[model samples]
Target: MTRKDNSVARLYRLAQSARSGQWNLEHDIDWSRRPRLPFWMRRAQARKALSQLYHGEMATSDLCEALLADATEDRYEVRSCLGLQLQDERRHAAAYQRYLEALGGIDPLDDGLQRALTAARHGPFGNLGAMLAYHVVIEGELLRLHGVLAQFVPCPLLRDINRLVGHDEARHVAFGKIYLPEAVQALSDDERRALYAWLEGLWQDAADSALNRRRANLAIATFFRRWLGGGWTRHAKALDSLGLPSATGREQAA
Candidate 1:
């Protein structure tokens, strides 16, 4: 097939997968299968989860806007990927919002959420390569962390939500893997170096949220243990090979 044909085929496949995944989550997944949490813990866990998710939505919105602001016609593939990512992020945020409402309404504009938004807005813009690195490398780490969380969260509702979110994230990571190399290859050596530095800085920012938080009531500790065991390290290596510095390297640079 021609390159144009391949691109069309890939786009179709991604769209189809996204549609199927959406249908499955909405229809096939037994949302009712999970028992309700006890009143107190339900409120607590929901608050915590919803707060984190709201902050994530704010951050992704900032990133998406930043990407769109810099995008050109030549960057069609990257724009397409970012568009899909933005959609997924919005959907995930809506899902969390629904859960929060079901548990009891949550305050959407918390200080934590505002701070996350501010952080994303103020983040450095190190050209197209650096943007790809942030999406493909740093966000990929978050996807892996969520996968681990899906396995161990005690509440069935949360487990189901995390599992569904993980599936969507896997597709985002795949899209990144497919496109990031091309973006990196297009950059000059000096641009690549700047991109790497920007990525390392983002990695430090991500590590605090992805690895450091201590949620006393949830399975966060168990998830962290599994993440640290080998999984996260492997992910770090994969990201490193994709042009970002490894987690250890990021720490050293810091």
Candidate 2:
């Protein structure tokens, strides 16, 4: 396998960056601040969004656990970066849970997120697949959504939470961007195709979730399409760069 010795520095820097950026969910967040739900976003919608966000953060922690459990000593830098990500995910989940409590407690996990988590846990990709599914696909989508919420949501606390959490998530996605190409290059063509197939299934399961299909004002809906399309395009390019199968049919199907 080809290893980029230079990436060791980058990975170490990422871990340090995460450590420096860590904040106390209890003290850092302005818990007393309340959400100002816009007319476009109903109270129910806001609650649902937070609930889903909480669950998403928790699922990411689970993915980190899966990755770390299978992590080997040889990949010290990679594991170190992922270890910090596990910390970030746990903090993010707790922050969201606290936010939900202020907003009248957590709502049920969205069906789409639940299904996506289930598929991720049972998927055939093993460790490499786990990284691709969560770090690459899911985190990319989530980062975009977080940006949108930060911009549109009027709540001071939600905005603050999104900013901090998004910072950590961007790093997670960066880890995938830098690592996946090099790691995937060692795979056989058949293996690459299998990876793409697994990605396609996971993407479909997530895209069809209720969170993505939520009804909203036309302007917000349009914004979602634009942001989500950009995310998909970027993810598709990453796959292409990795020599994975074309996602054309899957894109059209979505």
Quick one: best lDDT, which candidate? 2
How many clashes does the backbone of model 1 have?
A: 0
TM-score of 2: 0.83
Question: Model 1 lDDT vs. the true structure?
Answer: 0.59
Q: For residues 150-254, write the lDDT of model 1, one tens digit per residue.
A: 543456776677677777777776766666655666766666566566655554555545455555635866655565456445655666666555445656867
Clashing pairs in 1: none
Provide the RMSD of all predictions against the true structure, rounded to 1 decimal: 5.5, 4.4
Q: After superposition, how far is residue 149 of candidate 2 from its true place, in Å?
A: 1.8
Give the poorly placed runs of model 1, Cα more than 4 Å off.
1-12, 24-42, 65-71, 74-80, 107-122, 126-130, 205-235, 245-254
For candidate 2, write residues 1-254 as lDDT tens digits.
23576677778888888889888887887777776767787777677777877888898898888778874635878888888989999999988887877778889986776777777777786677777777767766667667667766877778888888877887887777677777778788678777888787677666655435754567656655565555556776767765454657445545
In order of listing, the candidates' clash counts read 0, 0
Lowest lDDT block of 10, candidate 1? 111-120
For each candidate, what TM-score against the reference?
A: 0.66, 0.83
**Candidate with maximal TM-score:** 2
